[model samples]
Target: MRLFTIGFTQSSAAHFFGRLKEAGVTRLIDVRLNRRSQLAGFAKEGDLAWFARELCGIETEHALALAPTPALLGAYRAGEVDWPEYAARFKRLIARRRIETQLDRARLDGACLLCSEALPHHCHRRVVAEYLRETWGKVEVVDL
Candidate 1:
């Protein structure tokens, strides 16, 4: 099984949706620390759901399985997190009930982990992708 993780920075919603359709994504796993966005249509969850249904016939879920927290910040700062090491400590912290409580057991056909940062190298989603890859096997990190 291949797990895909990606971020949508300044890319247009229509463009991202099109790419997702081409990618065969059946569901979107949003890993944003905060669900709210300042950008136009992306800010409203209803708008995204509508777009997903009409454009790609896919589904969207704001999964807390990859949330960031203060403890996570501290770990990353202390070097125990190894932000660049790939297998992020943040994933384990997030898996805890206090921060996150889910296994992402949902369907994985063309699944993408969504975040705000378009650049994968600079985004926490990159680390998240790595964690999932190491734990679960094959995984893809798409940055656009």
Candidate 2:
């Protein structure tokens, strides 16, 4: 399986969509806890879904199971937890949630996980991808 991850922050709309199209991503799985935030601009849930479908012919869906809980995110943002701690907690949360069983394996093929961090280094999307790769095996993760 080819699993891709991407972040929309610090990226222009053109660049974001272009990357997805160039990657041949057939579906975009939004893993944000807050999908309809006004701060998201073009990446807001409704607008993003429409633009992805109309412009890139890509299907979009939200997978809250892949998102960090509100409390976990708050702590990370508040500096109570560092990136390594946050990543560890997130990995544990997903393991408890059994995300490998929750998500459809076939749907992940050619699918890109979406977040708002602008990079995978400190983002939960990377953790999710790596966890899935470890759990499922034979998964090639590409950070787009």
Candidate 3:
């Protein structure tokens, strides 16, 4: 399976959509906990859905299962936990949710995991990709 991850922050409108189109992404799976936040700007649920279809002819799906739990996010943002600890707990959360079993391989083949971070290094999207790759057989991940 082929998977891609991307962050909307620090990216211009043109660059974000262009990257997805260039990568041949057929679907974008939003992994953010809050999909309708005003801070999202062009990345907001409604805008993204429309832009995706219009600009790239791709579909978008929001999957809360891929987001970090509120408590986990709070802890990390509050500095109560570091990246490694936050990552471990998030991985455990995925395991507990059995996300692998719930995943649709076909839908994910050309899908990109979406988040707001500027990079995947400290993001839950990377954890999702790594966890799925580790437990669900071979998967090629590209951080777009």
Candidate 4:
């Protein structure tokens, strides 16, 4: 199985959708704690769903189960918790949720995990991908 990860912070509409198309992403799984944001522009929940369907012929599904808890995100952003701690806690959350079993494995084959960060390195989407990869062997992750 193959999974892709991407962030919209530094990507324009063209660049973002273009990369998805290039990756042959069949579905975009939004993993943001807050999907609706005025500052998200084209990446806002409604707009992104519409564009993914109309422009790229890709499906969009918002998976709140994949997002960090609001308090965890707050603590991390407030610098109360460091990246390593945040990452550890997020991974544990995923385990507790048993997200791997709950997720549709078929849907993940060509799916991309979406987040707000511009880079995948520090994003929870990467952690999600890694968790899944570890659980489901032979899984390949492409950071977009």
TM-score per candidate, in order?
Answer: 0.73, 0.99, 0.98, 0.98
lDDT of each: 0.65, 0.97, 0.95, 0.94
Write the residue-wise lDDT of candidate 2 on 20-68 in tens digits.
Answer: 9999998999999999899999999999999999989999999999999
Tens-digit lDDT string for candidate 1 (1-144): 555666666778777887788877878778766665556356356677778778889788886657677566566657775655423456555445433124653465467777776667756666666666666666555554
Clashes of each: 0, 0, 0, 0
Candidate 1 matches the true fold with a TM-score of 0.73
Per-residue lDDT tens digits of candidate 3, residues 1-144?
899999999999999999999999989999999988998989998999999999999999999999998999999999999999999999999999999999998889989999999899999999999999998788999999
Alpha carbon lDDT of residue 10, candidate 4? 80
lDDT for residue 111 in candidate 2, whole number 0-100: 98
lDDT for position 101 in model 1 = 22
Error of 3 at 63 (Å): 0.5
Clashing pairs in 2: none
Off by over 4 Å in 2: none
**Ten residues in a row with the worst lDDT in model 4?**
135-144
Clashing pairs in 1: none
Q: Which candidate has the top score in lDDT?
A: 2
Write the number of the candidate with greater TM-score, choosing between 1 and 4: 4
